[model samples]
Structures are given as structure tokens and as C-alpha cells.
Target: MPIADLLDRFRPGASVYLPGATGESLALAQALAADPDRLRGVEVTSCLLPGMNGVDYAGLAPDARLTVFMLPAATRESFAQGRVRLLPLAYSAIARHIAAAAFDVAIAHVAPPDAGGRASFGIAADFSPIAWNAARQRIAIVNPHMPSMRRGSSIALAEADLVVELDGPLVEVAPARPDATARAIAGRVAALIPHGAAVQVGIGGAPAALWAALGDHRGLRLRSGLASEELLALADRGALASDGHVAGIAAGSEGFYRTLADRDLIRFADTRETHDAGRIGREERFFAANSALEVDLFGQVNLEWQGGRPVSGAGGAPDFAAAGIGSPGGRSITMLPATAKGGTISRIVARLSSPSVSLPRNLADVVVTEHGVADLRHASLDARAEALIAIADPTMRDVLAEQWRSLRTAMA
Candidate 1:
């Protein structure tokens, strides 16, 4: 069907869910926003939109609303201006939330049908399947440019209520290069991984660098929330195990997509399957490496807020951290620079000013910084404080030690 006709199917007051991140349909979103009158009173929900295509829902129509689960750079200003509604939830709970809401329509960008007439969700599988199942109308933009993925990452073409053929390039996001501090942290994180480990890497510069450091390690398996070019490099180097990789999303440059085209090494699953704490806990030798904005003396990780505003969501950090640390042979590693703001501010603080805590102290295992690694897995309160302080910046170590002494004295 024509793009205009496909868009005309949307009715007033309809609730629509669009796949976010690299799986967003830019052409479809542009068509939806072309005429405000056509989509008056419509509610659109998505997260991590890469470009400025469908951000201004307020401009589309006075009654139109945009709801987001996670704040992306493109939509942050819109959210601050009250043009977008932020639904704060952990990444693992997103699928459940969508199922409860029961959207009217679910639009996803997917690869063309394979030999078995199946269309892969491609790079952005996070919660698309859950939303699509709950939505009244299932619409798919079949793009040949999308990589044909393997395993349970696909949906049948017959299942979609409407199919619109579009030939366009997928959105590309270049990975950020890690600096010297980040590389040092990555090295410490990589040292914690054992051979034949099931690794879950979070999104960040340090995590990206960690992949490069692990290229020499053998029999490593990736079970992550997002896949990047670095992961492909690991596979190319024969570092990943033969059991295959499992992830929720594929985010990297166009070259990365080309590398994954028609490959069966990675399987994409929903957030529920990928980020389930209990399931991950059962996987032996699970190692999770994540990044944090700030960590307190109590070992609490703060990934959501900085200064008083929300920069990112909790995401899968908490889920993976608990699972990795809980597993009998698994380990959870948190990496961050010892300081920020040109070495003026300490990231390891006595207390977090932000109310949000991504990971509690109990779940923390190994904390890594450029200075050193702090193993807090089996430490008491006093011991944990000392271990964390040792990895902190050299200049702040004495101050942290003094603060620890004062806290102990007050408790006594």
C-alpha cells in the first residue's frame, strides 16, 4: 500500500507504539507527523530515537502526546519542555508495562522475509515483540537494508496486519573511542573474566573498550543488552564460544550491520528474556561489566541522575548486576573514572545527592577505576569502605579514609 494510505489508517485517540533506538522507522514517523490534523489526539510512545524525525509531537497536534521510557539526546529537550511524558521504569519491566497498557498499534522496522517467510526484528528487539502482541494492529516496515537475524528474533509476515515495503538505510551510531582512563578501567574489568564465561556488557565507553581487551581471551560468550562492532570483532577473532550470542539490540555503524547480515551467531530476544535476573542467575560463569556515573561509600551505584536531572534510565544495569553477582561462579564488575570535571570532582562520594540508586550496595561486587580494582563481594561495611577508598583517586583517598573513620565513630 502507499505510505499516505497506510498512515490514514490511524484514528484519533489511538495509542501507537514505535520501536526505538536503531529500529525506529524514520520514513513512517515522518509520514505520521506530516499532517497534524490527520493524527489529532493520537498518543505515540517510544524511546531512544536517534534523529530529529518524530520528536516534536506537540507541533504535530495540540492533543497529540509523546511518551518515552528512556530519555535520548534528541528528545531530552522536548521532555524538559513538557512536550513529552517520561515513564520511568527499569529496562526489564518495559515489556510488562507495554503489555498492561495495550496499545492500539505497534509499528516496527524489520528485515525482509527469509526462506521460511519470517521477518527479523533486526537491531531493535528490546520490547517490540511484547508491544506488538498487545497492540490491536500490528504494522511492519519491511526494509531490505535491515540485517536478517537468527533464532527467535523474527516475526511471521502473515502475523502483521499491515506490511509496508520500504528500502532505506538503517540509522548508524558510531561508537565512542575510549581514552586512557577508560582503557585502564577496561583492562581491570577484562582481568576479572575467566575463560568460557557468559559476558553481559552494558553501554558505555569503558564497556566498549573492554570488548577490545577481551579479543585475546578464548571461549567467551556474549549475553548482552546491546551488540556493537567490537562484539563482531571478538567473533572474528574466534574469541566467542560456539554456543552463540544473545542480546536485545544491535547498535553500531553501517559497517557493523553489514558484518552481521545473514549471520546466525547472535540471537535477539525480548527484554524479559534477556534481562531476567532469575534466568541470568542460573547461567553459570556469568560475568556482567557495566559503567556508572557515581558510586557512594556504601557501594551504591547511581546511573540515572546527575546533579538533579535525569540523564539516563536505570536500564539493565540493576538486573544484570544482581544476576551476575548472585551466580555461583559469576562476577559483576562496575567501571568508572575515579574523578570527573577535569579531575576536580570525585566520582566516589560519601553520599549520593541524586535520589535514584541504580544498584544497591548489596549487589556490588568488583569496582574498577584507573587507580585500581576494589573487590567488595564479601566485605563488611568497614571493609567495603576501605576497599572502595583504595581504588579512588590518590588525592581523595585520605579524605575518604577520614570520612570513614568519622562514620565508624558516630556509629560506635
Candidate 2:
């Protein structure tokens, strides 16, 4: 009935399905944070996306153990302490895991009820529907500030056992201003995308520049896991179709959220709908432009692991990559800068030293960097290595070529 009661349930160590990313409810999180004892010995599970949700749940509850799909910076300390366990799952697989958990409570942040008595999942719809449906108890923070999403994303408010009314600012991603390098990389990606294509572009400076580069594109559809603020600019320029943009979640400034609600630009979809291969395959031109930490000579991608630990989850990238690569007329494009770590390290490596290969070489149709584009589709093994090395940072190219030769010699 009230948030006080909700906090009471949490203190007793109820298995909670507190969603992160755009589904995060700052109201409930603050309420629990206000009383540290409320979180003691609690077991929390979430798919807290890296770089999206920064709350340190284990820090708040000293005795609490957390289970997360991705390792965000906020949770790194806990992870290092063995208080957090990671599940390296795809976006669709994460939904399946949440369904199996049957958590005691599933708390969601939703738009206030409309005249039709339905509360929209609003800014976040990726995994909320699955959690809400599978949990033994349902709670919703009825946030007036949450965008009122229209379409199949709304749920009846009566379904939630506890409905807490809260009016406060939601979590947001600061708007990204693409730099010259990002713009150059995005320019190459823009040229590869045809007008009227459905694109799956993720967040960050490169994607923001991708939208700016497509300023003249018409009738484009955005089918991405998360919507960046750049969607507004595209919509303003008539580059994006009115009803063509859809995403599983929205991450941007609060002002962007308001404009999205006012313009009804993004239709939020569940993970099943957004990541469905069959659904994406049906789209005429499903070009997925995703970021990767590194790509080896064979074009294998590593998007998750860095150093010796997991920094991010695979999420929907694999789903969209496979779907886009398999799409009859669509191509899967992986975009990244030529270097990382302030230009000291090469993103194009001779071999993926990371223990994880988030995406296989088969899904790598094209690789784009500020330097140039590498079309690896239907290429031979030797040809693939040469093409990838050609696009590598000029200084690193020689080193990578030597490494590639070593690999080939070893293979022989």
C-alpha cells in the first residue's frame, strides 16, 4: 500500500528484482538507502547495465550479496570482494534467468496511470514485463516524471500489489558531443547505411556522430536496445520516420525524456520483441552499428571483457549482430576507434587475448574505424587478416602484421 511497507519487505531479505538502467527507480533506491538497516542481509538481483546504473547496492547493505548480469563501475568494489556474482548472459538469456528466479518482489518505475487506467512501462521496457510477470509480488513506483509511452508497453496499474507514488528526477545519461575522431568514424558508418534502413546503434559519442552524419537520410527506422538523445535530432530533421523508431529502453537527459513523451517518438518494446531474430530479419535493411572493445585478425569481437575481468555484459549486441548479419539485405557493422587508452593501445589486435568472444567472426560483416572500412564478408582467412590489419592504427599495423604472421605460421 505504501513505500514504508515496501521498505519493510526489503529489510527481511526478500529476493528483489530491482531493475537497473532506465528501469531504475531513484525514489525507491533512495528510500532504501535512507535506512541502511533496511538492506541488511538482502539478496538483490539485477541486469544493471554498465555505464548506465551507478548505484552501489552492496555498499549500501554490508551483508547483502548481489547478482548482476553486467559489472558496472559502481559494483566493481563489491565484485572484487566476492560479494557480487556475474552472469555473462545475452539480453534474451537474462530475461530467461529472471523468469526462473521467481524473485519475491519485482519493483518497476512506471508512468502514472492514464485515463484508461494503464501505466506505461515508459522509458524502460526491456526486462520489466518478464520480471513483473514472474515475480511473486509486484510493486511499481508510479513516477509522474516517467514518460507516458504509448502502444503495447503499458500495463494495468491494478496488477501491482504495492503502488508507491513518487515525483522526482529519473536517472539519465549526459548528452554526448561527438569529437572529430568520432565524427570521422561515424561518417564511414553513415555512408554504409542506405536511406529507409532500420538501424541498431548504441549509445556514446560515435553513435551520436552517426546520427549527425545521417542528417540527410530519410525514412530511417531506429531499432536499437537503447535510444540516445540523437534520436531527437534525427526526428527533427525528418531523417527518422514518425512511427519507425523503437527501442527496449530510453537513456538520455530528463528534458529529452519529456520531448520523447511529447512527440511520442520512441515506442518501447520488451526484450523479446526488440531482440527477436525473426522480427529483425523481417526488416528490409537491419544495419546494426555496435561498438567493440577489440577485434582480432580473424574479425572475432570482444565487447565484454577487458583486462582479466568482465566490464560489460554481451546484452543485445549479439542478438542484433546475428540478426543483422543474417538479414537478407542488411549488414552488421562493428564501429570503433582505431585505438583506445589515449591512443597507446590498438583496438585491432592480432588475436583476441580476452577470455571471452562476445561475437564470433561469422557475425562480423564489416568493421569501421576512423582510418577506413574493412569489408570482411565472404573473405578468405588470409584476406580477412590483411583487411583488418590495413584498417589498424598506422603505427600498430606492423606489430599486428607480425602477430598475424606468427598466428598463421603456428596454424600451419
Candidate 3:
């Protein structure tokens, strides 16, 4: 069918759901944005918009609104300008939210059908399955460049109501190269992981460094929201367990996607399975490593706000952190540099100035900085504060300690 013809199907006031990350249909979204008349008053919802197509949300017709679950660099400006709606939901709850909202249309990028007429959801499978099941209209942009996978990660052609076939490259994200600080934090985090552990790694320099530092570990398994090149390298090196890895999405260079093509070593499941706390808790020696913008004396983690403004969403950090911490013989680790802004600002503070709390103190097991690690798993309020302040940047440790003491005195 013609791509323009498909745009005609959208009705005013309709709710449209699109997958985020690399699963977004670039050509289809561009076509939709180009014809504002067809999309007038339509509500388009998606997460982690990479902004590869250069679609201007503010330029879209006045009635159309773009709702984003996770704020990306491309949409940050628009969000600040009040041109986009931001919904803060963890990756695990996205499917439920979409289903409850009863979106009318689902647009997804998928691989071409195989001999069995099944198409893979490709690099992203986070909420697509749920969106497809809940939406009244199912539309797919079939891209030959996408890799086809096994049963659990694919959808049948019979499910799609409209199909627009286009051959193009899937979106790719270059891995964050770790620096000296990240490497130091990664070393401390790596030391905490046990052999034959199931790991969940979040996105950022610290997690990337941790993945790179785990080459020597044996029988590691991945249960994560997003898989990067480092995860591929581990599997290639025979360091991962033979049981295969579990992921909700894959966001890496083209080489990483090719590695996943028709391979059974990694199984792409929906967020429901990948982010389920109960399921993750069942894994032996589960370890989750996440990055944070700030950690306060009370052990609260802030991953979203910067300078008192919303910068990102919670994503899967909370789910994985709590699950990993609750699992038997498991641990949740948060890593970040002790300081920012040329060491002028400390990331470990006596109080969080931001409104968004990614993880509460109770869920925090370990906090790691380039300077050292703070084990808060079984610490009292005063002990937690002391441990955290001790691992802060040397220049700011005394200042944080004084602030903590003042806060304690005031409470008393």
C-alpha cells in the first residue's frame, strides 16, 4: 500500500502509539509529520525518540501532540518549550500504560517476513507487542535491513492491518567510550559481581565500562532493558552463559544488530518479562548496575533532573535496581563520578535538589564512585550518610560531612 494512503487512515483525536529507540519507523513518521492535515489533533505517543528523522514536533500542526515517555536529546528542546508532553514511566510499566490508554494505532518498524511469514520486531521489542495487541489499527513499516529472529521475538504478517514495505538501515547508537573515572568506577562495580551471575546493565559510561571490565568473569548472563556492543562482545568471547541472554531492546551500531540476526544466543522479550521484578528475583546472583545524576546522603538516586529541570525519565533503573537488590545473593550498584563541572560540583550531596527520585534509599545496595564504594545495604541513617560522604570527592568530603551533621542536629 502507498505510504501516503496509510496516513489517510489516521483520524482526528485518535491516539497513535509508536515504538521508541531503533524500533521507530523513520520513513512512516516522516510521512505522517509531513502531512499535518492528516495528523491534525492526533496524539502520537512513543518513548526514547532518537530524532533520527529530524521531525519537528513544534512544527507539526497545532492540534497534533507528541507525548514522549523518555526524553531524548532530540526532543529535549521541544519539551522545554512546552511543545511536547512528557510522561514519566518506568520501562516496565510502559506496556500497561499504553494498554490502559487504549491507543488507536500502532506503528512499528519490523523485519521482512521469513519462509514462515513471521516478522521480527528487530532491535526494539520493549512495548510493541503490547501496543499491537491494544491498538485498533496495526501498521508496520517493513525494512529489509532489520534482522529476523525466532518465535518469541517475532510477529506474524496476519497481525498487521497495514503494511508499507521500505528498505533502509535501522537506527544505531554509538557506545559511550569510558574515560578514566568511568573505568575506575567500573573496576569497583566489577569486583562485586559473582561468577555465574545474571546482570542487568543500564545505559551510560559507567555501565559501558562495567561491561568492558567483566571480560574475565565466567558464566555471566544478561537480563536487561537494552543490550549494547559490550554485551555482544561478552557473548562472542564465550563469557556469557549457554542459556542465552534476555533483553527488551538492542541499541548499538550496525555490527551489533548483525550479530543478533538469526541468532539464538540472545532472546528479545517484551518489557513485561525483562523488567518483571518477580522474574528477575528468581535469577541466581542477579547484579544490576545503573548510572545516576546524583546520590544524596539518604541514598536516594536522581537520574532524571538536572539543575532542577527534567532531563530524562526513570526508564528501567528502578525496576532493575529493586529487583536486583531483593534477589537472593543479588546486589544493585549505582555508579557515577564523585564530582562534575571540572570537580567544582559534587554529585554526592546531603540532599537531592531534584524532584525526581529514580530509586529510594531502601532499594540502594551499593554506591560506587571513582574514589571508592559505599556499602549501604545494611546501614543505619547515620552510617549511610557517613559511608556516602567518605566516598565523595576528596575536596567535598568534609563539606558533605558537615552538612550531614547539621541535618542530624536539626532533626534531633
Candidate 4:
């Protein structure tokens, strides 16, 4: 059927699900945006990542509403105007929410069917399966450029459900080249992970540098929520224990996606399996590395909310951190630059700028900054303050110490 015909099928006030991660159907999203009349009075639900997928679904039509777990830059305006509904759910909880929403239509961007009549998710295996099951109808905009993979998530391709064929490249994010500060933190974090350890790292320069720093380690495995382009280089340098890794979604450049598809290097999983603490803890030497906006003396971490609004989401940070903490032989590692805003502000302070249960003190087994590392797992309140202060930016140390003293005086 024609793409126009599919757009015409949408009823006013209907609920729709747009797949997140690389499975997002840009063709459909663009069509809906171009033809606002089709999306008016419709409710759109998605988990569009912060850095990717900049379409403003809620703004497509005044009556349309977007419900999402992430508060990316694109949605900030809509959210403030009451057009977007922000769901403060963990990465795993969002999956459960999707199963219950029961959207009227689900748009799936996929690779063409293989010889066996199967379409794989290619780089995205995050939420398509759940979205498909919860929707009344599923429409696949088959893209030939979308790589077909032997591993990761796949669904049976049915000709009857094929609505339109679109030719476009899937979204790609270039790997962030680490700067000196990122490299320093990465080096320290890398030293903490022993050989043969399993690690989960979030995206960004610190992670990119950490991957490069681990080139000499052997028997290392990846058990992560996300896989990026760095995995390609790590594999090339023989840093990984095996070619097969467990990742919920692969987000990176076109070259990396193609390489991942060609090599079939990872097993795609959903948030449930990837973030389950028990399952994650079963693996020995599991380390979850996450970033934080700030850390208090007690080590409460924050990944979301900045400048009076949310710039990010909790995502899988808490999920993986909890798993690493519970794993008897594993540890949770939190890495951040010691300062922000060109050294004008400190990231480690007497108190977090905004704390809302992102990650508790217990999850902060080890905190690494460019200056040094703070092993907070076995430390007391004062000891944690001391260790954290030691790792803080040298310029901010005296001020942080004074603040800590003031806090203690008030408590006494």
C-alpha cells in the first residue's frame, strides 16, 4: 500500500507507538509531520533518546500529545507547554508501561525480509517487540539500507502487513572523541576493572576513552544496555573476550552499524533482560559505569534534571548500578569530570544540586574523577566526604571542605 494510504488510516484521537532507538521510522515520523492533519488529536508514545530523534511529535499538531520517558532537547518546549507528558520511569519500567498502553498502531522501521521471510531490527532491539505486541496493527516501512542481521531481535515478516517501502539511512551518532579530562577519568576507571571482568558503560567521551584504554586487557566481556561504535575498535584490538556480547540496542554511525550487522557481534535484548539485577549479578566481576550530574558528600547521584528542567533521563543507570552493587564479586563505578562550566562549578559538592533517588550512596562503590578515585563502598560518612573531597577539582577542594565543615557544625 502507499505511504499516504497508511497515513490516512490513522484516526483522530487514536493512540500510536513509535519505536525508539534506531528502530524509529523516520519515514513515518516525517510523513506525519509533513501532513499534520493526520496526527492531529492523536496521542503519540515513544522513548526517543535524548541526543537522537529530534522530531517534536507533540508539535506536529496542537491537539497531539507526546508521552515519553526521555526529556530530550527537542521536547523541552512541548513539555513546558503541556503538550508532552514526561514519564519518570526507569529504562526497564518503560518497557512494562509500553505493554500496558496498547497503542492503536505501531510503526516499525526494518530491514527487508531475508530469504526465510524474517525482518530483523538491525541495530535496534530495544522496544520494538513490546510495541508490536501492544499495538492493534503493525506497519513496517521496509528500508533496504537498514541492515539485516543474523543476531539481535527479529520478527516474522508478513506480506499482508507491509505498508510502504522507504529508502533512507537509519539514525547514526558519531563516537565522541575523548578529551584530556575524559581520558584521565577513563584511565582511572580502567585501572579499577580487573582482567576478565564484565562491564556496562554508558555513551560519551569517557566511555570512548575507556574502551581505548582497555585495549591491553584480555578476557573482558560486555554486558551492557547499549552498544556503540567503540565496540568495533575494541573487537579489532582483541580487547573483548568473545565476539558475542549482550546489548539491548546498538546506536552509532552507519559504518559501525553495518560492521555490527556484518559481524553479527552482539545479542540484542530488551530492557527487562538487560537490566534485571538478579540476571546481571549472576555474572562474575560485573561493573556498571555511569555518569552523574553531581554527587553529594553522602554520594547520592543524579543523572537527570539540570537548570530547573530535565536534560536527560535516569535510563539504565540505576538499573545497572543496582545490579553491580548486588553482585558479590562485582562493583559499581561512577565516573565524572571533577568540574563543569569551565571549572567555574564543581561536580562533587557538599550536596547534590538536585537529588531524587537516581542512585543512592550504596550504589556508589567507587567514584572516579580526573583527579583521583574515591572508594566509597566501605567508607563512613566523614570518610566518604574526605575521599570525595580528595578527588574533587583542586580549585574547588577548599570550598567543598568548608561547606562540609559547615554542614557538620549544623548537624552537631
Where model 2 places Cα greater than 4 Å from the true spot, the runs are 11-13
TM-score of 4: 0.96
Ranking by TM-score: 2, 4, 3, 1
Winner of 2 and 3 under lDDT: 2
Candidate 2 vs candidate 4: the lDDT winner is: 2
Candidate 4 achieves a global lDDT of: 0.84
Query: Which one wins on lDDT?
Result: 2
Q: Give stretches of model 1 more than 4 Å off.
A: 36-39, 49-59, 410-412
The clash numbers for all candidates, in the given order, read 0, 0, 0, 0
Off by over 4 Å in 4: 159-162
Root-mean-square deviation of candidate 4? 1.5
TM-score of every prediction relative to native: 0.94, 0.97, 0.96, 0.96
- Give the winner by lDDT: 1 or 4: 4
How does residue 248 of candidate 4 score in lDDT?
83
lDDT minimum window of 10 residues, candidate 3: 50-59
| 256-359 per-residue lDDT for model 4 (tens digits) | 88888888888887777888878898888998887788888888888886765688888988889888888868989888899889999999989877747578
Candidate 1 clashing pairs? Answer: none
lDDT of 2: 0.86
